[model samples]
Target: MFPGPTIPNRQPHREPWSRERLMYERAIAMGNAIDSTSRYTYGSALNSYLTFVRIHNFPVDPTEETLSFFTVYTSNFIQPRSVASYLSGVCNQLEPWFPNVRAARRSMIVTRTLEGCLRLKSVPVSRKRPLSLDDLQIVLSHFHHNPSHDDLLFISMLLTGFFALMRLGELTFADNPRLRNWRKVSRRSTVTFNDIQYSFHLPSHKADRATSLAEHAVSPTLIQAMGRWSSEAFKIYVRKHPVLLHALLFGADH
Candidate 1:
């Protein structure tokens, strides 16, 4: 007789998913269009704004908000950088169809919220640092010592976030081949040449104000790892022990 023990069968008690939660499925669909944190951060900003809006029964959406509340919203945030990120997102959306949406230049708009340099009166926002080659090398070297899924996840983020210069929100995991494009970009390290590829068409910044923004996406190797080839389906690289970000494609930086 085989020495292995018999396995017990089990089934989940919870329903597959609730209807209200299912409603969020649309949001999930849209969320799936982009990376994970895009789902979180953008959703977080929207939730914050909407919570404030619903609380006061504000009649207008963020775009239609009177300048007064816009000011209040800015002053209330602990981190005005998020506000800037949110506004920049809206600006991106309006520029293509509604050119008149963003009136003040970015400097002026930010001046209204995030504080300016030289003690200029504006919002006081947080600061962030860009990753350097030395920093990235250190991260990879550490990963080499401790091989794990997180390591692969970070490698993808560094490739996209720094090399491809993708935003946090755009660097989502693509567990579905239907969405992610797997095309190799390089073969410099132990990673295979064909293993390189990333997302080809990542979701755009829903709040950007620029009229002619650059194409978005990340490195190819990342896409291969995060992007799935399923029939249909679906971090931070630095600081705070880092996190996840699916993958990127070609020179894309969505």
Candidate 2:
């Protein structure tokens, strides 16, 4: 024991961390993050955290400043929805480290991150867009003396669509309530477009992304041929026919 006071045998007081030890210890600790193949994904998140720490000597606490730093750092690059994949690793490890997050409101950023991207699209309304009698006439005119496939489809749509104002999905999809009944009825006689919606309990269709039908409505004869519709069932029918789309589009309601 040295003089001053007989110093009893004592364990050395541990020294505070040095920058060098921090770097070396960080590397050693990173070994834990590495996968069996020595790769880091979940481990890479650990790597990111360590790298962030080494770069900034950040504290071991989740603060608003920490959250801001993370949001800003990620904002450095534009990324796709695959962000979830990259972040799966970060989220797993940081979940315990990060504070609890409350339910967030719906916004463009959340929608974009989840849905990937936005697309400009047009879709038909399911609301009944009843056609005027004159517009019905324009649709009828397309029939001519003889009708082609397009003409027949066009005529069938118009004849049925006028009073019905149906969604394109129900029109195109044969499973429609009216279509199912029409299929059965059409077999009995030459079905008219007017009969499909007016007499039959045809439910209107709705629209959504990856769902619904296009906006364009078809012609009268098309309704009859396609749905085996009966025009006489309608309260009003196109009494005459016109020549072209413009005529129907800009027709004077009779």
TM-scores of the candidates are 0.33, 0.26
Which regions of candidate 2 are displaced past 4 Å? 1-102, 105-133, 174-198, 203-254
Write the residue-wise lDDT of candidate 2 on 1-254 in tens digits: 66664667586788889999998898778545533322345665556645665678787443445433543454344343333343455554555446342111123344343343212221232443335566667767757778889888877766655445454544664453422333322232333347433344444322111001111344444534443435663213233222233344443332
Q: All models: lDDT?
A: 0.46, 0.44
lDDT of 2 at 9: 59
Sequence-dependent TM-score of model 1: 0.33
Instruction: Encode model 1's per-residue lDDT on 131-163: one tens digit a residue.
Output: 445677888887887678877987876665655
Per-candidate clashes come to 37, 23
**Candidate 2 lDDT for residue 232:** 68
